[model samples]
Target: MNSPHNPLDADTLRRLQEDVIDSYDEELELEVDDRILDGPAGLSDEARESRRVYFRELFRLQGELVKGGAIKRITQRLNPRVCRVAALPAPNDREKTQWYFQRFVSHLPAAGEIVLFDRSWYNRAGVERVMGFCSDEDLEEFFRSVPEFEKMLVRSGIRVIKYWFSISDEEQSARFLARINDPLKQWKLSPMDLESRRRWEDYTRAKEVMLERTHIPEAPWWVVQAVDKKRARLNCMHHLLAQFDYHEVEHQPVHLPPRERHEDYIRNPVPADMFVPDIY
Candidate 1:
C-alpha cells in the first residue's frame, strides 16, 4: 500500500487513465479536432482552448463548496442503510412487513449533521414501481404520502434537496455499451440495469409522474442535464453551493503541543516473512 503522498502505482495509473478517457468531453474533442484540422494552431493549443472555460468554471465553483470553513449545526443525513439494502440482497420477510418508511426514519439526520440520499424513498416511485416489485396501491400510497413526508422533514429543519440526473436515450445507450465492452466496468452492467435500459420509456414516465406529484416548495426536485458527466458533476455541485448562504467561519490560532519522548522507548521490528512483497 503506497502512502497518499506517493506517486501512483501501475494499477492506480491505469485506473486514472481510464477515468480520464471515460470523462473525455466529446464536444470539446470535436472542437479541438476541428481547430487543429483547419487552423494554424497545434493540438495542445486547441485542446487547451476547448477545456479552458469549463475547467476554469468547474474549479472556481468547487472552491466554494470546499472553503466554507464552519462547524455550524446544519444537519444533513445520507441514508447509507437504504443504499446498502438496494445494492445488497433483497429485503427479508421482516423488512417487507415493516412500514415502508419506518426503516428510513431512523436514518434521518440529527441536529448538526448533513444527510443525503442517493436513491432515497423515491425508489418506490422509480425502480421498484417499474420492475413490479411494488404493487400499484403501494406506488399510489407513496406518491400521496411523499409530499407530506418531505414537508415534515422541512419543518424539522432537515433541508431536503433532490436532484434527478437526466440523460438522453442515445447517451444512455452509449454509456451502457461502453460499460459492457470495458472489462473493469462490466460489473456495473447488472441484469437490472440491462432491464432498465430496455424500459427507458417506462422510467421516463415514472420520472414524470414522480416530479409532478412530489414537487413541493419545501423539497422540489431539480433535474440535472447529465449527458455530459463533467458538466453534470460541476453543475450539480455549483447548484448545491448556491442553495446555501455561507460565510467563512472564524477560528483561533492553533498551537501544537510539544511531543513527549522517553529515552528507554524502543520500537520492535517484524519478521522478514511477515512483510508483504513491494510488487509495485
Candidate 2:
C-alpha cells in the first residue's frame, strides 16, 4: 500500500536507484559529499559561519548539476545576446572579470539567446570594485570597455535586459535561518553567502556603481524588490515574456488514419503468461 504521506516513498526511491544503479555504478561512487552549501546569515560581530566551507562545495556542486531553464526571446532588434549569467569567479591580481569576459567573448554569437541566471559580462561598480577585486585601473578599464560593448551589442541588434534581484541582509538572514532548519533545503548553504552578508554594504555600494555605469537607455536595467519570491518570479516572467512578439505558433491537430484504415490496428494477441482469471 502506498503511504499517503509519501508520494515517492523511500522504498520507491530505493527501487528507482536499483534501475539507475547499473548505469551509474562507478561514477556515483566517485560523487562524494562536496558540502558546498552557503552558510545561513549571521550578523553578530562575534558570530562566525561555522558551516560555510561545507556550503561552498555544495553550491559548486549545484552549479554543476543544474542550469536554469532558458526562455527564448526574439525582438524587433535581434538582441543577439539576451543576458550573461555566471557565478563570481575567484578574483585574480590582474582582473576579477578578465577570465569572465574571455569565456563570454568565446561564445560571441551565442548558442541561442543567452539568459543568465547570474550575469558575468559586466563586473559593474558594485560587488567587484567595493570588494577590492580591482584597483582604480580595473574600474577605469570596465568603464572604458562599457561604451564599446554596448555599441557592439546594439549594432548587432541584441536587446539587453538586466534584472538585479536585491536582498537585504535582514531578509537574507531570515532565508538563511529557514534553510538551516530545513533538512531538504540545507543543500542551498554556501560560504560565499556568508561573505556576501559580511560585506552587504560593500555589495550595495558596488551595485550602485553597477547601475550608474551599466544602465543604458537602449537596454535599461530593471531592479526588482526581490523580498517576495512570488512577486519576483511573476515580475521577471511577465517582463521577460513581454519582450517577445510570440504569435501563437498554432500546432495543427494530430492526424489519425481514417476509421476503416485503422480497423485492424487493434489486433489483440494473448500473452502466453496472461493467465485467464478464475471464474467467481
Best model number under TM-score: 1
Q: Candidate 1: global Cα-lDDT?
A: 0.67
What is the C-alpha lDDT profile of model 1 across 89-115, one tens digit per residue?
Answer: 355789899888776787777764455
For candidate 1, the per-residue lDDT at 72 reads 12
Return the lDDT, model 1, position 68: 48
Error of 1 at 10 (Å): 30
lDDT of 2 by residue, 1-280 (tens): 2345534546544433333332232232134344333322432323224234323433342332222211211121124245443454554666544543565555444534544534456654665676576678868777777767767776787666778877777667656555554465568787766677788787877788778877888777888777754345445555665665654344479999776666558778888679777777
Model 2: worst 10 consecutive residues (lDDT sum): 68-77
* Model 1 segments more than 4 A misplaced: 1-20, 23-46, 49-56, 69-90
Highest lDDT model number? 1
Model 1 — which ten-residue stretch has the worst lDDT? 69-78
Instruction: Compute the lDDT of residue 158 as modeled in candidate 1.
Output: 86
Clashes of 2: 21
